[model samples]
Target: MDAVIIQILNGLDKGGAYALIALGLTLIFGTLGVVNFAHGALFMLGAFVAVSVNGLLSLESVTLDPTKLTPWGTPAEIRTKLAEEWFGTFGTTLIDYSVPVSIVVAIPVMLLIGLIMERGLIQFFYKRPHADQILVTFGLAIVLQEIVKAIFGANSISQSAPASLAGTIDVISGVAYPTWRMVYFFFSLTVIGAVIAFLQFTTFGMVVRAGMADRETVGLLGINIERRFTIVFGLAAIIAGMAGAMYTPILSPDYHLGMDFLVLSFVVVVVGGMGSIPGAVAAGFILGILQSFAAMEAVKQYFPGIDQIIIYLVAIVILLVRPRGLMGRKGVMET
Candidate 1:
């Protein structure tokens, strides 16, 4: 029973990430009818933002003390974090909480990037062929990946959770889980709920949804639907960015990190049904749980390497069984 609970928690942790990414993907698809192959790059960029913030916070200033001599050395050198020196305890706290702090920086940075990408490039492809959209966005993703590789190098950079969240908490009598993972799960839920509520309750979100349902009619009604859709793209980017930033401690990020998650997220989107927000979230958690169970030693003994292929297998079965997915509209993805 404890083992089952542990696996369920593991599934939720993984599912949160999958759901967040898939939700963003669904938003872009549903709002703009554009296949954003570069979505994953946005995620990678968010992780790098955390890395950059941490690096900035930890920047050290070196000084030579002429009055003090090291053994066999002419002078003693001292180094101190510039942030700590400037802001003292507050700066120290910022550095310690760099990953979480990066979310603040990432929000504006990612929003700007998303807005620029949509206005400068993506808007042109709005009526283009899906193949063209895929090719162009994929190319953009590669360009971003190469640029990051050039700057941060090809090595994976590790991120640490805040000192306060670095340990495990007991969930039940025998099940213990990482505090950070639990935080991430709840964070994901909060973000998800916020997005849903915003769309369901706000006038702006209502206009966006109306535009999504019938863009031409909405525009005919004198609404600037295109501008609202552009904002939706930015919102999607923010969601993806937050997911990546929060996931840094669990997965050390590299240039290829986005590509790694990109494929699986695409699978999640497909399994959830194209442009279906609820379906995406549901599929994410379902697939995550299945993958976790498949990774168990006992399961592996019966079905070697099941964990690696489990998601794909489930995706295949789901697609075959329900062509439009669990909650997808009947006509979506239909030939």
Candidate 2:
């Protein structure tokens, strides 16, 4: 039915986000062999970057004159009257232009942050034990969240899509679908495609893949495997951050969004398997669609608390049956 189709579309977008985050997680786990618990924080940082970009763009000055004449050389009195009626110096002057411009600004800023975190923090833990690595990255995640809070304040930052994307579109004769949500879906798909292409065809990706297979031999051959791992971590952070940035319109940026996403992302990664890109992508969509099915108004009425249990229930069943996950490698977690 129309309702079912609609929910499936809705779930795809959420799945796209999950796929993106999980893909990054799988890449790091497969290549660097490090269980990064800080990935959620990176996602949080991305959303904050969008917020920061929006805030920065708000600093622009319109430089309007209350008494200035118009293109038709309208009377100063009329112009002044209009300005007095509709304008204020204290409030936002560029509210219309801020969101679109913020997206452009958030990317580079977040990429730089990603590089810094990888080079400075995550790199050190690459050689450490899983427990130490987990603690360090978890601590780093906390630190990152605190830093975001300190800068953006403890409260969530308000942001939404541009005016052009604020409303809904009529997909059929009777239904009007939300434009921002559609845009989010498209944006996430674009990112996921680019990432998949990078992993599938790029030389750098090939090298990383090589390293993932046998890092010891790759290092013995004189390649800087550690440096590649650092880059991988940074790349992972950038992916999470971009996802966060684009998600601002869907969910406002909060200090805890990182942790929020981190948990679901981990589930996504695990359900996909330890290091399978296809698995991550597939599981993300599967879980997303399943979530949608569970949230159905009719289904919820019958299942009672279906939304709360659907994901966990599905995960448990998958792990019980697949053990290593749908596409998981036999030796992945065992070693």
Candidate 3:
């Protein structure tokens, strides 16, 4: 029972990332009718944003300390973070919470990137074939990955949660959970809810949702549906970026981090149904939990590496059973 609880929590934690990424993917697909292969790269870029901010905060100011002499040197050099030197205790605390604080930087950066991507590249592919869109976007993803590798190198960069949230939390009598994981899970849920509410309740969301249903009709009504869709694309990028930024502490990020989640996110989108937000979220959590269970020693003892293949296996089986997807509309991919 305790083990089951543990796996469930782990699954939710993992699922939060999957759902967030897939949500953004679905939004782009639904709004602009574009399959964005570069979405994962956006996620990677978000993580790097956190990395960049942390790096900036930790910039060292070195000064010679005559009071502390080295064994063979005239004096020792004292190095301190510029943030610490500038703000003292407040700066130290800010640096300590850099990972979380990075969101502020990430939002604007991602929004700008998304806007440039849509206005510059993706807008041209709107009327192109899906294959072309996929090829171009995949190429873009590779290009982005290589650019990051060149800038940050091809190694995993470690990020730590704040000291206060680094410890384990006692959830149940026998089951303990990581504090950061819980924070991440709740944070993800809140973001998801906020997005849903924005789409469902607001006037702009209504127009966007209507455009998703029928862009031609919405445009015929003089709504400037294309511009709204562009905004949607940017919004989607922000969601993906924010997810990646928050996830750095959970998974040390590397250049290939985006690619690592790309396939799974696609699988989640397909299983949830192309353009189906709720479906994407639901499938993400389901697959995440199933994958978690498959990783158990008892299960793997019989199946052998089921954890790695469970998601794909499930995808195959589900597609066979339901061609469109679990919640896909009748004509989504039929054309």
Per-candidate clashes, comma-separated: 0, 0, 0
Q: On a 0 to 100 scale, what is the lDDT of residue 43 in model 3?
A: 94
TM-score, per-candidate, Cα-based: 0.98, 0.86, 0.99
User: Candidate 3: where are CA atoms >4 Å away?
Assistant: none
Location of the lowest summed lDDT over 10 successive residues in candidate 1: 326-335
**Per-residue alpha-carbon lDDT of model 1 for 101-192, expressed as tens digits?**
99999999999999999999999999998889999999999999999999999999999999999899999976889999999999999999
What is candidate 1's CA lDDT for residue 100? 98
- Model 3 C-alpha lDDT per residue in residues 1-335, reported as the tens digit of each score: 89998888999878999999999999999999999999999999999999999999999999999999999978998999999999999999999999999999999999999999999999999999999999999999999999999999989999999999999999998688999999989988998999999999999999999988888899899889888888999999999999999999999999999998999999999998988899999998898888899999989999998998999999998888987787887677578
Ranking of all predicted structures according to TM-score, beginning with the best and ending with the worst? 3, 1, 2
Q: What TM-score does structure 2 among the candidates reach? A: 0.86
Q: Could you say which candidate leads in TM-score?
A: 3
Q: Which stretches of candidate 2 lie over 4 Å from their true place?
A: 60-97
Quote the lDDT for 23 in model 3. 95
The alpha-carbon deviation from the true structure for residue 218 of candidate 3, after best TM-score superposition, in angstroms, is 0.4
